[model samples]
Target: MQSLSNRLQTQPDASTATALLQLQAQVDGDPSPAPSSDLDGMSLGGLKRKRCRGDFEVCALGGEVGRDVVERGLVTGEEAALYFGTFFQGCDKYVPVFDPSYDTFDSIRRRSSMLFDTIITIGCRAENGAVSSQYQALSNTTKSPIAEVLLGTTLPSIETIQALLINACYSEKGWMLTSMAVRMALDLELPDAYTQLCEIMLQGSDNVERERDLFRKARVWFGTFVLEHILSLDCGKRPGVRADGVAMRRCRVLLGSSARTTLDFRLLAQVEVCELLSSGDAGADVLLALAHDRLSPRVGVALSDRELGEIVQGTRIDLSIWLSDWITLVETAGATEEEKASLVVNLKIQRDWSEMTMLCKGLQGIGIDNVAIMSEEQRNLIRLAKISAQRHMSTIMSNTGLYLGGFRYGMDFVWAKCAFSVLLLLKLTRLLPESSNMPQLIADSKVLLAELSKVRGLNNIYFRILSLSVEKCERALKEDLAQAANPQNSGTQLNFPDAEMEFQSYVPKEFILEWSFPGLTFCWIPFDFQDLLMDFGSGL
Candidate 1:
């Protein structure tokens, strides 16, 4: 009887070995043994085993696994712990989705490879040489998996959406990743997740684990929504996710619960700010209509210059109201002093950027030649843009030590907006050279851009392009100054034949082109000057 029992055990082991051989053969594309009933019985729960040989083959060819556990080989446990700590310390506050107290490196890595790799990639921004090297290595290793997720080959999950949002903040593929993330968030029905959580709470459910999971999904959706609007403003496009009042209210209700933390307050503040920016008054509606007209050129009734001026005035009032409300919220937000300070500076930059964007929109189709004939409204808009740009640069400069030093705790779009403010100052200087303070503002902006370009983590392609443009603007400004100081340098006289000719020839096309970075949409530039801003430094 003992011998018989041993034989039966050996039979099961032999059948399992045969099944393993069959799976290996399938993966290797080799002929395998014929089907056997024993293999069927060996299947888990009597279900047919699913084959994932192709996935393994793809990963093998790409030299990295395409699953959550894939990081086990590429990132050591120690490295992952270090990255997780670094990311939570510096980067997570801005996004404020992950809870460092609750989520561990192993838990996140086991949940989603994309999120884990993204966190590591952003964490690698540290100044240490070892961390920098690891960043490059981790970035390379994660690219294939990220591409696979983006391509929809992998299943969509809340973690993947969060990863895409985080990636959008820093990666060059921001717009693309954000669009994908929005689509995925919708696909996963994330917005409704908040409502469901609310319902669950109303039912007095005591399932803490389920409540936590739903809360996480809700947070991810909110993060994605807020980021979409921010990026849309940055890219001069409309946001994909519309603000839902019901969802926002539910989120607020959750915020008042025991689970609320300081990061939740920051997230709520961002959501409210974005919503206010997107919700404009009558003046904003008119500007939007004009933008639409510019894009399509339909023969619609045009508003008089005076009417446009009224719109600008209304828009400025709306901005003031928004700022007042924001200030009130910041004062009463109940966050720590450090957190409140960081939030204020970051939001102030964004607020100034929104104003500049609106003002620039008003200047669309009005070129250098039309400056003299511009109505008071047009000139007022230019003045507002100039002031906004100055304030934007000043805000950035004031916080230079905070933003540029350490881990550089702001989004890529924030820096892009800062660079755009510099370009706007240059553009405004070109438009109104007689403004007494314009030269000093332009010079200060140039110095700021130079400093930004020198920062290791903040030096991106947008900053590099801005740096080049500012350099050229400085040279042009110096030449103009030199000409003003000594007018008898054998060149043409100071007086011009006509305003049109002088305006056309004031800044050579080369200098304007030097200011442009092709395919880069940092902020709104006038449609007429698009060609002037073509990529002049292609070789560079």
Candidate 2:
């Protein structure tokens, strides 16, 4: 099995290959490199002496101690390139500076140690751990002196993006940092190069050399576009670029031939997903799309039951097709076992989330007051919702220790998914059959949250909110169970106009399912459910 570095070292871009050869020659020409003392401001012995325990123990080991860690789930080339493309696109000059092969101390002559150190710090968080202590260790390592330096520096364009990506990668708990990263990327004028390429392409250039340069530029712009779109969706913020933006139009050029590989394909698919969300073609997840708008302008947009059902069904079909093609392409592209597993888990979670969203939309439309006297179809929706939540939880559990030595690619996002699944399960426990294993599911979710909390940091306010939400859920469940035991006691009327409001308020506001960034900043604003929440509050 070729290593991530090796795979990245062999990525198919002809220009990248030539540049690497040249970079290798330049490094080789300098026989006497900087002294170790001056290089990272640490002696070789001192560098080896600093170590990390807990979830990141393997990564912090010495030549002997870290040998197993390095051999096992090292960062993949694709991950490195993805991050690179995500933030450093259009600026080819900074490519080698942040390239993965230069990740080691041995390759630290030209590159910044801050960059190298940041990768290790974030990578450590994804390490598979058997206990919370491992996660604790991972969190603490981010506070290391070296990491502190990198975190605090105001690097230039390329390094700024590099630093921002690291910050976003490590600070996965909240949208604040991620949103900040998006904002910073825009401020640096990162996407401007791609815009220029678009102009050049349309100017009628038959020059093959210029065409290749244009292709590269278009890809870079697309890379930045992908980052902006995904982060925008995740943060519930408006995307910097619109669906009909120049970047999207130029990005499709890849579909002509440049997108045959898995990475490019994923990028293209993500672009489409972003466009769908932006264009409000989100199918069953239309509520989420409207929420991302931040204004809740579509709150009044009404679809009849049949129309909504058709939309949901259409979405499911589209996602099914995308998922199927994604799987086949990844397998056919010769991705490693680890890569395949990671991608599959992420995809399955996406599917489950979609199902849950559809279920939620249907439930909201029906209103809680109607749930007690729901039609067969409504009951069926509840069943599917429970199954979807369960599938999401099960998939998450199966992939819990995915970071062990493999790529810790999506742990932060996975944490968010786990939180979402747990909240859904808590809500479903109220509606599902009493014999359902909801109690056990809820217990497992709490444990998962506890573990994730340790990794996110003690100061992470989002996890604290999640913990409180879980408690509120448990309390609500107990109260309901007690009420169920005393059937003779009079409760609120089944057809009361206010029943839905009561139900919405029953689930703690914290568990309201906003994908805001990590940490405490009272500035978090939620919109998708906002209109519904406001309507209920206003007695509508």
Candidate 3:
């Protein structure tokens, strides 16, 4: 029989669940855990059992979990539901009290609704911890007791189980969750479903930002939790992992030493991109860590200004090389332009988080500054994100193809017009010849422009860029560029339409500009476009 302590040692996921259950079945009294249904034992399952090697690998988290318990005859209708019901509001006392005949997500959620009702009665105080210690306590108990129930083995200490779960809930991102951090911790697996009772307890949380952040955090934790659940499915002693160290060490995988080197930044090209679009910092932080550590060859995180400077010096800026790598990464899913756009946008946001912090500190220390100078490097990051988005768009559009995913050339392609102005803004920002020799940025922007201007370079829409640059120069650039003392506060974009007479100097036609900013859609008049709005607002 496998010891409870041994099962907690691996990276848990769906694959590991089967192993965990086999141990549970070996106990003399575990009356098969499977439940019967109207279809006479015909249940469509995600994973198929192979060789029926273990005793009981059941978990309430889905996949192999619901299976082994039913086959082993350990739970029945009311007993199973009552047993799994505790995770919900009023249901917490229910699941532990009665075993359920069958396992279903809908049933689990209902149990949660009961729990929800209870929380409401006590002023909903139980909802305070996003990641609760209460849930963690439940999880630690379940993974181990499960071993005892099936394998007839001695149980693990309560403290050891608690520590394993606490670490599991410790999200890779440094989101200082509320003490004992319950919200994130709730992702842990036990033997039942409690979602419904929980949802009722959580009312009116429909905020956009909140939902987005919540989803992101869920993805990361769910991935981690599932992996652990699967690993615990192992059948033998010290089952999941040979040791727990393997899983723990994987969490803090390091980036190379070059991550600490200073970047000249002059050799680096730049782009300004939107901040990550997640609802909260927790999810964004996790995504950022993934991008920094997993996506790039040289990963960095939370570097100080000096460290950032060292990184810039150590790294080489070869746009073709870097873009190739980035584009390839973005194209992996073969997703549509819209989907690709969303993912790319996320990728940019993560990159910005990883790189912008230290860049901001470095620029704030410029010699002649009375006020904090907005880091050009940060601006470059934003610019980089925009161009990066534009560059992959065609490849994205190409891969999804026009027929399958609503790929019409008119309205669908109209979004391209908006993207053009964004890229132009980045190019002009890079072209600004400030005292700092950021020629690399300018050169990089030019390369990006070559890609964007595929429409014979005719996308001249805005007046400011033409007004700013005297002439386009590559090496020994002569145009003087002024740095914004507080670029963060500057307006990089204005609602400038081609027809507005008030802004007649900016357009070829004056009378056409009389309509409202929102009414520009129907303005059918056409005119020669030039420098276009040279830059999209700011970088990161």
Candidate 4:
């Protein structure tokens, strides 16, 4: 009988070939297989395995066939190119760590098939329905590999981290994926890449390619850090990555370097915004801590109305300053008029969002026990929150094109922010007297939510929640208007038997548990709408 190695080398299947390669590498005292000049006579799946081992030519020739055979899917070279172009053009702007000029489809595919598939999935999902129909199959193909990497069954690389971060923007398990990405990034010591790159710069190394590679790794770490904060804010959880002043300084220096692009500047600006929003001094942070205590058995001291006011005012001032500084930088950064407009719009929206967050925190801090005789400061905070919600919703409504066009391509947090604005407006409408423009605002918000819901690849939970919430709010507002118009009916309460049943039917319990509303914790229970609405009015 022939030896095991001889049998494997003579007629190797994909699994046996991989095992043989690993054994050979172990014998050679190297963990990775070395490049071999001799080509193995293997089938398509085995060819895919060889391609994964750095045979670029094999991948270039049989890439589609190998993927079709292994993943049970097919993406022709032309389709791959189109999807790659789509991702870099639309989606890559938000996640700017990946450089299209440097990482072409062929190059990325050669580096990691998982990353390649992730890019294609996102790109496909960003397209119109006709094109996006392929998204599900492609996305399905990526799940197994991603799970393997996440479970430690497959070793992770920087490419895996990038794939996870990008997919997290669209995945239902976004928070989990983001947490894993941060952990993998730390394990890879990506945070230290910047220091090493700086050392090389100081040493006067003339290796441009080496410097570029280090910059990419540094960008990846920053991307992970930024994503961690964004997802944390969305879920009302503390970020996995702590605030690092030295890391921020390093990021600033990197952005100021000649190699920095407009995208890098935008990412740095996001880092700064997240930093300010998550600061201990920020009202959002205070509220998050309070929320934790509320959910726990331990009783915590509530902030005085005066203290809450100060926090809100201080947060507003900080947000204003931050916005002003970034606006100036954005204008002077040599970006085009369109880019400037988009940046300014985003900044103003964030400013409004932060203000609303602070005001909501203030509202929550003011206990409902004394709703009838609320403090003047508390009333003022409610007024400010209402105005901020109005302004934020108005911005979203007016920039319908921007949000709708970019919704599929941007981060999931954008959808969360929009949902928060709608819910805030709903809460404030009940707390405060009905304004002349409240109906119009509600109508516009409905339209905005409807359009956003139509965006491809959007998480359906957001749409279902927002749609049902808006419907209930509108019905309640109409009832209030009717009661005021007729004194006899003023004492009569509106019943929502059908609405309640529909909401229960549409919104699953798991979705309620999974989807965290930023400031509207009460929204998790649709059945408690009456109580929550009364609670909002209780502090009025």
| Predicted structure with the largest lDDT when compared to the true one | 4
lDDT of 4 by residue, 1-540 (tens): 122122111121244335445545655677675444333322222133322334443222323432531244456677777877888866887677776567887788777777888888777777643245577778777776665554343444788889888888777667788788876766566766767777777777888788888888877877887776666655656665554233343345565454566677667776655444334433222233323333222246667777666666776776677778878888887778877777778777767876776666556545442233566777777778788888888887888877566776665556555665786676665556546376786788778876876675345455665776788767766665775688675543444334433432333243346554433532223335557688889995
Q: What lDDT tens digits, residue by residue, belong to model 2 across residues 418-471?
A: 555666666665555556865676687677675565554334444565576577
Give TM per candidate. 0.71, 0.54, 0.25, 0.75
Judging by lDDT, tell me the better candidate of 1 and 4: 4
lDDT for 492 in candidate 3 is 44
Which parts of model 4 have CA positions greater than 4 angstroms off?
1-73, 128-133, 196-207, 246-250, 274-298, 365-374, 410-413, 434-436, 449-461, 492-512, 518-540
lDDT of 2 at 168: 50
- The CA lDDT of each predicted structure is 0.57, 0.46, 0.27, 0.62
User: In model 2, which runs have C-alpha deviations exceeding 4 angstroms?
Assistant: 1-156, 172-224, 245-269, 276-301, 358-384, 403-414, 432-436, 443-540
Candidate 4 lDDT trough over 10 residues, lowest sum: 1-10
Q: Pick the candidate with the highest TM-score.
A: 4
Model 4: lDDT of residue 50: 29
Model 3 misplaced stretches (Cα beyond 4 Å): 1-108, 114-308, 313-326, 362-540
TM-score, structure 2 vs. true: 0.54
Residue pairs in clash, model 1: none
